[model samples]
Target: MSWSDSFLVLVLALAVEAAFGYPGRLYTRIGHPVTWIGRLIKALDRSFNRETWSAGRRRAAGLLALLVLLAVTGLAARSMEFALAATGPIGFCAIAVLASSLLAQRSLHEHVAAVSTGLREHGIEGGRAAVSMIVGRNPQSLDEAGVSRAAIESLAENFSDGIVAPAFWLGIGGPTGAVLYKAANTADSMIGHRTPRHEAFGWAAARFDDLVNLPASRLTALLIVIAAALNRNASPRAALRALFRDARHHRSPNAGWPEAAMAGALGLRLAGPRIYGNVRVEDRWMGDGRADATAQDIDRALVLYRTACTLLFGLALTIPMLIWLIAS
Candidate 1:
């Protein structure tokens, strides 16, 4: 299919996911796409990631495993796309529904907002419980401000990673690209770590995920800045400033952009030092704002997130029209 058609698919998928996220019942009946991908990664790791092998051999095995994963995922997605290609509107809608599963728009909002609700209703204990669900850090280490900041950080990072990246790939490479990206991302999450076992073995998955996520990260940051511009309470100028000043300093190459923008737009400091499980990671701060974030701040961040999502949908719609106009 043409790029225009792919973008149209993206637009419809965004709308469907935003309106009704993958239903819980549907997930119960048949596992979600990511879960399916995760199972495959688990199988590959069990079969190939042998500890006795030299690091070089293991790394080679890792690359080979990643290639196999991508090949299988791409072939399956392309086959489905081909099967649906001749069905006209019905096929388009069906593809869009399948594609919608890849996005996290509605679920991200719900999860982040749950933190605020938990904080407001049940105090620190409630806040920790809710925030723990979304963040990898030790929830017990956080105070009220820390909990709030963690939630906001997760919202910003996930906005780019979970929502924008998938949609961006969908627009560019159709179903094959989107699913293939998801497979790589899942592999990274499962094995792309600095741990002795994963460090060498997961190099390819980690590096490739970082590369594919580059454009979407910047685009997500820009969308957040624009959303800030539209919100009276948000500071678009601060968001833009943070993008230039602090994004690169962040530990992650891509996560910094949206995190910094969200921090500046919301006037909060985020992603400095944190304890993940037992390890203390001393990362650079993202925004030059208040560190004592509150539940109200989380509410504000959700506003920006919602606005950014809307802007993303708008962007998806606009691209197809532009492509059509240029072609004409």
Candidate 2:
């Protein structure tokens, strides 16, 4: 497909996802496919128990899995394209719907909203439980402020990973690109850790995921800052400063951008010492003004997220129209 065609597909897919979201409860009841994918990876991980496999074999397996996922997604998209050519616009709409199902805009919003609701009703414990699913950190010991910070941070970070990054890839490479990026991200989530078992084996997944997210994460931060300014809660100056100052401090190069921007926009601090699988890492704080974060701050962060998403949808549609005009 041409670049313009891919851009059109992305806009349509984003519209579909933004409108309908992933059928989470239904997908969950039917068995979450992503969870099943993780389980499959876990099962395969057992084969490396020998502790003596050549590095070459591990690398080969990771590459092979990535290639298979990419190929399968490509075939699916090509099949849809063929059907569209033979059938009609309905086939194209079906392809768009199928592509959008793979993105998780609605799912991300629902998870974050659940965290906010839990905080409102059940306090810290409830909030922690809701946030824990999205974050890798141990939530059992988090206080109210910590829980609130986690929720806001997850909202900022996932805006890039779950929404913007996938959309960016889809714009560039169509459904095939979206699927490949999702597969890499899913693999990284499943195995990307500092644990002895996966430290070496997951290097490729982690690095590739970072590469995929690099640009989208920065753009997500910019969009969030713009959204905050539009909401009258934050200035562009603070947003830009926070984005540049703290974005590199986070372990993941891409995640820090949006998280830092959210922190600055909300005038709250995020990221610090946290336990992960019994290991403790002293993370640097992201914002400058305040250490105390509240449930209200979480709500503000959500507003920023919604605003950014809306702005993104507008931009996606406008960019295509502009390109078409220039070409004409």
Residue 324's lDDT within candidate 2 is 92
True-structure RMSD, every candidate = 0.8, 2.3
lDDT of 1 by residue, 269-303 (tens): 99999999999999999999999999999999999
Model 2 C-alpha lDDT per residue in residues 1-328, reported as the tens digit of each score: 5667777777888888888887758676875535655565665566542357666676666555555555664576567666774666676677677678767777888888888889899988889889898888889868888888888888898899988988888788776777677777887887776666676667677888888889899899989989988988765677778888988988778888998898888888888777776878898888886877877888888888889999888887887888899999
By TM-score, the best candidate is 1
With candidate 1 superimposed using the best TM-score fit, by how many Å does residue 93's alpha carbon deviate from the native? Answer: 0.8
- Model 1: worst 10 consecutive residues (lDDT sum): 83-92
Clashes by residue pair, model 1: none
Candidate 2 ranges beyond 4 A from true positions: 28-50, 54-57, 84-86
Q: lDDT of each structure?
A: 0.94, 0.79
